[model samples]
Target: MPLNLSQYLHLRSVPSFRTILAVSVLLRVGLILYSEWHDAHSVVKYTDIDYRVFSDAARFVLHPTEGNVAQGPLGKRLGLGDPYTRATYRYTPLLALLLTPNEWLHPSFGKYLFAACDILAGVLMHTLLTSAILPHADAHSASPARDTDKHYARPSTPPSASPAASPTRREQLAMLLAATHLLNPLVFTISTRGSSESVLALFVLLTLHAAVRARWAAAAALLGLATHWKIYPFVYGVACLGVIGGERGVAQGWRGLVGQLVNWRTVWFAVVSAGTFVLLGAGMYAIWGYPFLYESYLYHVHRLDHRHNFSPYFYAIYLAYPTHYVPSSEPSVWQRVLASPLASFGPQMALALGAGVLFGRRRRDLVFAWFVQTFVFVIFNKVCTSQYFLWYTLFLPLLIPQLSMTPRRALQLAGVWVGTQALWLSEAYKLEFLGQPVFFGLWVRGLIYLAGHAWVLAGIMESYEP
Candidate 1:
């Protein structure tokens, strides 16, 4: 039979995943090669700041002797000091170890590694969507129930309380979602520039996949490794706990409620997660020692760089910054407190915990809870960056398929987010690149951007099926 216009257009809109993956890989590899060529040839060379740090760190990891790094050409050029302190390498030694192979292959080999992980993450999400993990409503009951002993129990393929799209529809949606993630400018740029968000993304997706499959040990281990890799992921431990607590934990009575949380499973999950995190930390300490403690993890807590940031609190941090370095300070204690990195602690934790309680029970497969939690955490975070956006956006494709939002609404919200970013970036460029005294103006713009972010988040809340 001949295909109608709508069917043809729909088919065109959702291309084959294999084709999409191939194009994505080729584009990333081609971009890496072109970038290297341009950097080598052009007077104005483009380089990602962190890529060099990653490369240098990997080199230092291979030859860790202090005299060797200080004497070698690599050390002379990159100024390789303590691996953690050198080139601002604020990461676990694992990344340096992971990327050392790239040094043998090519300088840009790390970019290829990041890109491969990026595509693989999308592939994994698509695979899970098509599998029995995120089973549609027709395949299983949506409502939660209790076993004879009042233990929380539910059907194998249950989605949120709502009926899910048919399997065929979900497959198409999964394809489109995977393609969206692969082509998203934010995700694409990060991987192209050799950021490890893709690597982190793979662990995150794997943890969620394992949790959804009831493989508690695997989930906990992956989650632990992820948390060790990036401190922020530690917050998602709540969501993982929710998975172990109960898929739905029937809300019929106190017995079901007791079974939901106070159980062996939750304890085992916590123990394994904590154990894995401790082991990784101990290993890193043995290799890198005290400096690793300060640079990789501790530095983040007290870090304060108020020079051109997106947070509205930057102005406060800036004012407080001057008081610390001066021999004599006259600013009030309140001003000093504002300058401290801990200023945003209260709201960040409150909102994150609130999101966890709010979204824990209702999930689209397994991501809705963590997605909401991470979104709340990043927006309210003291230090927000482009890579921070990737934390939550990683799961967006999976969540979007289950959202009640239309394509048009999603596009509009996306425009709002982009427009706010553009507004902030324009001001940022003026202050940073043009040497303008628009600090106050930029702070106000940050406030506007914060409002824009909150507006977008509210829309997401409204559209969420749960």
Candidate 2:
């Protein structure tokens, strides 16, 4: 049976922005209480060591450890240490600087700070959805007069009896985006665990927001900072460039590329983006020298820590080169090059394929392409961790409004995503924390995760009513 007008209105009203914020604040308070009590049963008990690493690095930044020049040119320590005091920190220097305030304040300040960032991200999601994405989605369904006024006026009240006065599809979607961020389990987990992905996620959304507004310099600068924090964000450049190019009505050929290259916004974007990366890199190198550069940047290039990572490509790497799975065994170069699995080439292939897709849809809305780009970025990454979902989950809800699926279909797709994650985590936890021969189970989980995303992507593509 079809939902009646009142029933649909009730569903729409449930995810109102005010309701989402209230629930979010309450959830954060609960997390804070749980954190204060140090409850073992709390979900944060299985917190990622990445949080501790951030705190330690920031602390080191606040107070440098004394050492000799023999370690490196940077005075005492060769690198920042982790929770166990191991010299293995793996983030850019800017992140440490960003978190230093948490160190200066109370020990628990960092968790609260991350929680605040998550809230900020939700706000940004609301703005992006309502101002940038939703208006266009509504334009297709409503009269031009209503569409133009949708943003200028406050959200229209739910329809009384008049069908024309009903809450537009756009308002419902904006609420959905906010609700998804506020209630997302992954956001809660990452915030409670002190994952720095919160900070990165904020920058990512801000960059998209800027891109949507055609504030090219702001978009580029934000993307640069985000890319500096994590190399994967470099792929975001494609979305920004593609969107701006399309907006300007740049043609789909080499002539368009040439024209866009000379555009003032394009030139400004390129300059600021490159300048940020170079200046930051130079400043960090000046402060810490070779060790800092190697530990922060080069380490990732050679990182082969294949222990319990959630990448779909890992299973192929494990099967083809089983010796890499052996803690004591070092795979030969041939094994790494020839026998290594999907992620070995996945990023490049995904980027290429994504570029093709985005460029082909050169006339599609920039926001849609941005979500697609970032989603592909995280999915095909060499190291897919639980926290990595934050890279795109916040953006996916914003894109959902544009997809031509019914509410039931949307719920079903979300179920596929969440169900796959639940199944994968069940097996992953067994292999990661428990001593179980769940190696094959990990493979199954990877296949399922990969398939789920593929299905979601296909649905989005197929449902492109625009």
Best by lDDT: 1
Candidate 2: which pairs clash?
Answer: 67-76
Q: For each candidate, what TM-score against the reference? A: 0.85, 0.80
Writing each residue's lDDT as its tens digit, candidate 1 over 1-466 gives 1111112235446778788898888888887888888889988755577888898888876764644343333334554444664668899878887888776888888888898998899899898777743454334334443333222223333443333434555566667768888888778777877788889899998988887677879988998999899887777776666555667563446676456656788788888998999998876675566767777789888888777677767777876777455658577788778866667978888888666654555334357778778887887777776678888888877765445445566788899998998998898898888999899888898888889988998887765544
lDDT of 2: 0.65
Model 1 lDDT on a 0 to 1 scale: 0.72
- The parts of candidate 2 lying over 4 Å away from their true place are 1-7, 15-19, 39-47, 68-86, 143-173, 253-265, 319-334, 338-343, 346-353, 356-364
By summed lDDT, the worst window of 10 consecutive residues in model 1 runs over 1-10
What do the candidate models score in CA lDDT, each in turn? Answer: 0.72, 0.65
lDDT by residue for model 2 over 1-466, one digit each (tens)? Answer: 1111222444435566877888898898687667667645665554457766777777776664444122334423444422212256777767666677767676666777788888888899888766766665555433322323322322333334323233464456567668778788878777876777788888888887787777778878888888787777777676565555556565667777656545676566778888887777776676556766777777776555456566766655555456546757786675667454344556655764465345433423655665566666667766687667777666676766555545575677778988888888899888778878898888788778878986986666555434
